[model samples]
Target chain A: MNKTTKSNFITYGMVIAAYVIMQILVGTGSVSSLLKGLLVPLCIYVVLALSLNLTVGIMGELSLGHAGFMCVGAFSSAVFSVVTVDTITNVAVRFTLAIIIGAIVAAIFGIILGIPVLRLRGDYLAIVTLAFGEIVKNFINVVYLGIDKNGFHFSMKDSVSLNMEEGSKVIINGAQGITGTPKNATFTIGIVIILISLFVILNLINSRSGRAIMAIRDNRIAAESVGINITKYKLMAFTISASIAGVAGVLYAHNLSTLTALPKNFGYNMSIMILVFVVLGGIGNMRGSIIAAVLLTLLPELLRGLNDYRMLIYAIVLIVMMLFNWSPKAREFRDKYSLKRLFSKKNAQKEEA
Target chain B: MSFISYLINGISLGSIYALIALGYTMVYGIAKMLNFAHGDIIMIGGFTLFVVMNTLGLPPLVAVLIAIAICTALGVIIEKVAYKPLRQASPLAVLITAIGVSYLLQNVALLIFGANTKLFTSVVTVPAISLAEGQINISGETTVTIIASIIIMIGLMLFIKKSKAGQAMLAVSEDKGAAELMGINVNATITLTFAIGSALAAIAGALLCSAYPTLTPYTGAMPGIKAFVAAVFGGIGSIPGAFIGGILLGIIENLSKAYISSQMADAIVFAVLIVVLLVKPTGILGKKINEKV
Candidate 1:
């Protein structure tokens, strides 16, 4: 196998081995309820980080509104699950459909937002995405929707304003959000999605479209001069990234019984947290993102014993990680003994031959 | 009458935004990086004021001065420790570090101040004025905010136009290598910029709390975001642009809240930003530089 495939295999093997070990622990009853409860969410966060990495690390664009896309996937899927719960009695088929719906809806929103936004560069693009993200969250909050024998009802004012027929089901109740969502998201499904995200992102990075996207990121002017359609490639990468994030959102919605859009959940802070994960993971390193997301997500929980010092420690770790990652002396140290360097040496020998 | 009242309120709010935007605009101009921690500096300033006036029983003026001093020192220290090392790093890296510093400041405040809100007593001593047969009464904070912002704006303009340090700042912002070659102290200028920016933030904190009358670790976050939008709206590096953007944004926000749904005011403001950016990509007064291939 080539260098790329070999590295990809290593990453996949690591995840599977980890999963098996975790399953053993879970079966043995060695894991606590708190840690066990955290499994699905941890996987969800890992997916979110990877998806964001596709944009910030590979596409060379900083997005400050990623959670908005997550929010879109969540609320849309929640609506679908609520509406279809009775008709689709099978939980697996129902969740599969909801995930598909969530992905499609999020992709549509991404395209709509991206077409206008991708025209801008750097900070402007970042801020514009932020604005659109806020718009989506705000729009969701004010929206009210329901269904009855007559038809579906919708309004922007309030749920009462939807004016559905008597005994009709209210799918969305604005701030209160959708309740009674079936928790079809299992840890097994979470792991499967993670592996799927890993497969797709890893394979795509080695493909022609992925190369085109990276080329654009490296030098937009040069890429454009070389006949790489900047607009098409940018939108394609952005849409794909958004859809992946949406899928994670689907997992998130299902993992919980009730899904609501709160600042802590779907706001800019969440986006920033995802960005932190991407950056800390050594941007563009897919395996690194997974590890970073897992570790950072666990950091706060691990520091829980310290009480007030938990967040304080988390902040220090973020800064220290940044310093260690980018500082010149640390880079030299890492390069001397890093597995990445060892792999590069093997690739160099192959190229020379 | 209500419309007139809203307009006045908008202007008052806009002035506070203007004060905050000035700091953002200046730091962006010289440092070429967004200091996300700048907003937290305002929070730090507010807590300093609280400690001084509430705990030490100091006069409001002394408390305000102490707050400014404390924030200025904190800003310089952060720049030296967290940001200076990453001067050669990627913008994204620097941005993340700034975020870390912001998080550190916030969590630290939370530890010391606790999570409960503190009621802020107004420091502005000016009396309220009634105009047009008392139909349009203006609060002391509003009058002081508008006048103070204008004065500070003019003063800053003169300082930039005439001061030697300001000249060094302009040179460094224009070209750091060239500025160093020309014997201008680039690092010192950056430190000065952060110091000035933090001082302005302290003043802004005082005024913001006086108007809103609440103190919490998260107080500066939302307003910081709005001021950032304002800085972008007016053209990030231009002082006059920040002032105009702040006022216009305030007016738009207030009018929308009054006439439109108050809950959706944030969305409307962001929509306006997107529209402006689409029309003028560099912002209202931002200069467009051609990309050198």
Candidate 2:
């Protein structure tokens, strides 16, 4: 096998080993409840950072509405689960269907948002995506949806004059959001979803299509001259990135009993925070994104004892990490210590022998 | 509220948006960076004003000056420390750094001010004035906001038209390398642009707090984003476009809130932005850029 493929297998094995170790620790009652609660979130963030890297890092497009797609997935999946809970007695089946529905809805929205993105570039594209995110959040705040024996009912206005059975459930109550969602999500499920995301994205990156997307990112004009259909490739990466985010969202929604469309949860701030993870993890580096997402997620919680200084310390770390990663001296140091060089050196020595 | 009253209120709100949009557009024009922390600078200005007037019991005029000066310095420091190094970096890298700076400012403010809301007294407090036989009422704060915004606009226009420094700024924005070759001192001009933009943010903050009467560490964020939308709506790099865009955005936002669903107001505003962008990507007054192959 090639060196890169071998390295990829090593990384995947390491991740599986880590997951197994954590699960064993939890089973032995050695890990804290707080840490256990963080496990699923950590996985979700890894998925988000991974997906975002595909767009921001690999595809060379700046998307600021990743959280919006996550929101769409979360709400759509939550609604689906709520609607099916009565008929679909099997929890696993219901959740599987919900995940599929969420992925489809989010991918569709991704395409819709990605269409306008083709015409714009740079800051303008960023702003348009930002606008899309804001619009989604704002719309979620006012949209009321519910399912009953009377079938589906939705209205922007508060009064949803639907005649239903006495036991009808309100799926979404505007700003109050979707409540009593089935909490079937487990840490194991989260890890599996993240694995799926990594598998899809990693495989894509090594494929011929992936090379075309990267080629476009490296030089749009050059790629166009080579007859690479820019729009098709861009959409492929973007839609996939968004759908992966949707899976993460489904996992997130199921983890929570109640899901609200608060700004803190699904707003511009959330989008920016996810982007921060992708950027700080070393853009276009999947392993870096995973490492960054895991450590950064854990860092804030570990510093909870710092009380008021928690966020302050987090902010300082973000700035320092960015500077270190982007600084010229740091780049030189990284190049000198790169794993590729070490492997190549070993290969040359073997050849001489 | 009466239609005229809503119109007046929208105008006042629009003026505030215009003020903030000016800062955003100026920084974007000359520096070619979003300056994401521009919004946080507003919060700093508001807090500075609050501490000066409310705690130290300074005169309003002096308090305002101190706030403006502080924002101006903060702006320059941010440019030097965070932005200057990234000047030649990719737009994505620079944008991320800006976001980092923004987070730092916000978290620092949150650390100092705590999470609770603080009451902000109006900078302009005159007895209510009645117009059109009591059909329309204009508050003193609203009047001050409208008049001050107009004055600021006129003054800025004249400055850009007449002054050497203003001409330098214009020239630099037009073409940085060409301006540098002409001995325009691009660094100093960029620094000056940041200072001016930040000072405008301070004024906008003070006015916004007076109108809203409550301040939080996050008060500046929504307005900042809206003003950015205004900047883009008016053609990102155009000064007059920012002015008109801000005012138009304010009116649209307020009118939608009053007439349509209040909760959907933000959604409607963003939809308008999307439609406008689809129709006219360069914005109403933005110059079309041709990409060289």
Candidate 3:
């Protein structure tokens, strides 16, 4: 095997090892309760930030509706888990089926949303995505088609009806929110899912498809001239990013065991927060995105004592960072030192040895 | 009668949107960059009026004047601090900075004035004016909004066509380099453009607050986005086009909400934008520019 391949394998092994160790610590109560609380959100946010980085940073598309996609996944999974586990006798089969259903449903919605809005670029794209997010939230809020019988109106209430009963109707309460979802998201499961998402995203970024997406992002006209199919690649990035966001949403819903109204989950503020993470992490850099996601997710929790002042401080920090152009070191390294030169130097050193 | 009143109400709301759209258009014309924070400036103006009128106990009219003046200054400051430095940067950089400025201003407002909504009472105490068949009645707030918007739009048109400074702004918008070579102070002209745009926005904010009466830190976001859409719909760089576009968008959105479902109103508006773009990418009034690569 080539040295690069061997090194890549080692790196993957180390990452897997680290994830396993971290999972064990959380699972076995080896870490402090506070650290565990911090780690859970951090892991989830890392997936969110990295996935968003692929779209906004690497693909140079500003998507402000990522949270909407997440909401899609979360609700879809929650609904599936609620319906399927009751019908299926086997526990493992039910759980596996729910996850597959959730991810697939989210991916379908992602493609549906991506096709139209991916054609818009830059601020226009941002605005359209933002509108889409709001629209999704609103749509979820008002979509109440099921019956309103005495003592039990929607699927949420206790009508004592079995899953898939002839008389039973699916009803999503508008603005009142979806509640009483089953919490099946353990630390191990969340970590595994995050790892898988990271692997897929990293692999995609290294592949030819990823390069083409980046090319389109850099110069759409040129990419189009070279027959790179800008619209298709843009949609691909959108779908992939949306699907990852959906997974994060599923984890969030299962972890919380309750969700506010659709609007609550998929609001403009959530979208902005996601964008902020992408920006704070040094846009387009995977490691930077991961670090930023973790830090930002924890910062408010760390400053909980400050109460109302926490968001104020958070805003100030962001502004100061932006004003100073305080980017992560990895970004500077990538910009300053070309990959070709670094690889050539390493190759020369190997020859000398 | 109430339905007619709502219709009149919609038109007045549309007028304020048109006023705000002018600011978006003017800045985009010169910079070719959307000033995403422009709506925040309107928020600042409204908050400033609140501070001056309610906090300091000034007369409402005086407070509004003070807010307008402050917003004009803030506009100049925003241009210098956030936009001018990144003048040569990629459009994306400037756009991001604008977003940052928007967030910065919003958070600052949130810190100063908590998240709770504030009330801004109407300055005029006159009763609603009734029109034909007693079906259409204009509230004092609506009348003020319409009159103020018309006066402002006409004054702006006259200034751009007649005044020396206004002509300098026009010249700068047309070609900054040539305008600079022709002895126009480009920086001052740009600052003036911002000032005028922001001053107009402040007036719109005051008028809107009077009509609506509730204010929040993030309230400007939707209006900002809508005004931007209006600007683009009218043709981003055209002043008159912005006014027409803004009014049209406002009317369409209001009418859609009134006739159709309110939830589908935004979808319809965006659909219109998509259709318009598909037909005329340069927009209704926007001139096409040839690029040299």
B21-110, model 3: which lDDT tens digit per residue? 999888888777788889998899889988888778988889889988999999999888777766665666667677777877888898
Residue B1's lDDT within candidate 2 is: 43
What is candidate 2's lDDT per residue for B78-153, written digit by digit as tens?
9988887666777777777777788888888898988899999888867778998898999988899999999999
Residues A1-353 of candidate 2: C-alpha lDDT, one tens digit per residue = 99879877876876788799999999999999999999989988999999999999999878888889899999999999888888899998999999899899999999998887766777777777888888888898888887767788787776355444676677888888898899988888887887788889889999999999999988999999999999999999999999998888898899999998888888877777777678777889888888888987888688777756655665666666666666676677878888998889899999999
Candidate 3 chain A minimal-lDDT segment of 10 residues: A148-157
Model 2 ranges with Cα > 4 A deviation: A159-165, A325-353
lDDT of 3 by residue, A1-353 (tens): 97645644664575577678887886787887777766656666777887788888778877777887877787777776665545676756665666666667777877876776666567677776776676667666655424323322443223333234456555455555566666677666766776787678777877899899989878878888899988788888778888888888877877776676444457867776776777778887666676677777777677677756654555555554554452344346555687887888899999999
Task: Return the DockQ of model 2.
Answer: 0.56
Clashing pairs in 3: none
RMSD of each: 3.4, 3.1, 5.4
Model 1: per-residue Cα lDDT at residue A290: 90
Q: Report the Cα lDDT for residue A39, model 3.
A: 61
lDDT per residue (tens digit) for residues A218-256 in model 1: 988999999999999899889988988899999999999
Could you give the candidate ranking by DockQ, starting with the highest? 1, 2, 3
Best by DockQ: 1
| lDDT, residue A245, candidate 3 | 85
